[model samples]
Target: MRRVPESAEAARTLVRTALAAWGQRDLIEDAALVITALVSNAVHHARLESIRVIVTRPSEKCVRLGVVDRSRNIPYLRTDSDGDNTRGRGLLLVDALTDRWGTDRYRWGKQVWGELTCD
Candidate 1:
């Protein structure tokens, strides 16, 4: 998808469709939020014409959602103890919702991903 704010919605749609198709409907809500946050970060920060959105059921019990960009910058949480800062909470929210989340740095770029698994 294009590296634009509107692409976040498009990413959410792709996640929603993929989850339903994979019979992983239970993950759709959190997955959508995860994808949106990831996409928003890439769109806002990455210097590229487009970013890629990935949605895959890596296992029958797990769904993986990711956003790929050409930026090597990794994401970090904003630990605002006072909750006064409005920025940097995206990763915190993603961390709260996903079973596991991290980034894969590559020669070309990086993939920031999160996973949801059935309990």
Candidate 2:
């Protein structure tokens, strides 16, 4: 996907549609939130012109969403960010909503993934 500002919303819509089609509509909102956070982080921090969003079902009750970018910088929660700050809350939201999340580094770049439970 293009790493523009709109990519976040586009990823959300893609995750939402995929979840609905897979009969996992219960996970749509949480999945969308996580996907948006991951995509936004890739776009804003990695500064990649293009990114990749991958969604897969690893089990009957869980869905995994991953965002790949061209930078190896791993994301961390900004505990020092001001409560009113808008720019630093993406990873925090991802941590709160996802069942499990982590980052993987590759020679080319990094991929951040989050899992949501449909149950």
Candidate 3:
């Protein structure tokens, strides 16, 4: 996907459609939220040429979604709770909603993934 603000909505629509097909629509909201964060990070932070959003059903009990970008930068939760900070809170939302989340590094790029319990 192109690195743009609209990419987040595109990812959410893709996730919603895929989860609906898999009968896991219950995870749509959280999954959409996580993907938004993932795509935003890839676009704003990594500034990559392209980004890939993958939503997979590893099992009937879980749904895993990831965003891959052409950067090796690892994402960390920012603890800056200054009430005025407008950025750096995406991962915190992800952590609260997902069962587990982390990053994967590859030679060419990195993937940040989050899993949701659907069952």
Candidate 4:
């Protein structure tokens, strides 16, 4: 399923709903945090006109969540160049928390996706 929301709260809510529906309540907090960071990055850095959230279940024990933004710019993993900088740590958190995550580029935009194992 794909949902487009204009605000961060809305995006979080969408993620929460998906988590609930998947019977993965335990993952909601981290999932929501990741969604918020990705969506916020889409809105802020990509200047995306809209964002699409997609939740898919490929197996009984795994759920894949993707945040698609209308930007061709790809996201990268970066080490903090300055210790005092307050940003650029979101993807780092995602990497640490999720079982698997990656980015896919499409013709119109790109999808940043993460997989959560419910088992």
The TM-scores, one per candidate, come to 0.93, 0.93, 0.95, 0.86
lDDT of each: 0.88, 0.89, 0.89, 0.77
lDDT tens digits, residue span 33-96, model 4: 8777777667666654567777778898887777887788888777867688857877887787
Off by over 4 Å in 4: 1-6
lDDT of 2 by residue, 2-116 (tens): 9987988889888988898999988888888899889888889886589999999999888999999989888998888587779988989999999889998999999999998
* Cα deviation of 65, candidate 4, in Å: 1.7
3 or 4, which is superior by lDDT?
Answer: 3
Report model 1's TM-score to 2 decimal places. 0.93
Model 3 misplaced regions, further than 4 Å: none
Candidate 1, residue 20: lDDT: 82
Pull out the clashing pairs in model 3: none
Q: Residue 93 of candidate 4: its Cα lDDT?
A: 74
The 10-residue segment of model 4 with minimum total lDDT is 1-10
Any idea what lDDT model 1 has? 0.88
What's the CA error at residue 80 for candidate 3, in Å?
A: 2.3
The residue-by-residue lDDT of candidate 1 on 1-119, one tens digit each, is: 78989998989889889878877778888988899899888987898899999988788788889999999988887666656775577898899999999999999889999999954
User: RMSD per prediction, one decimal?
Assistant: 1.4, 1.2, 1.0, 2.9
lDDT of 3 at 3: 87
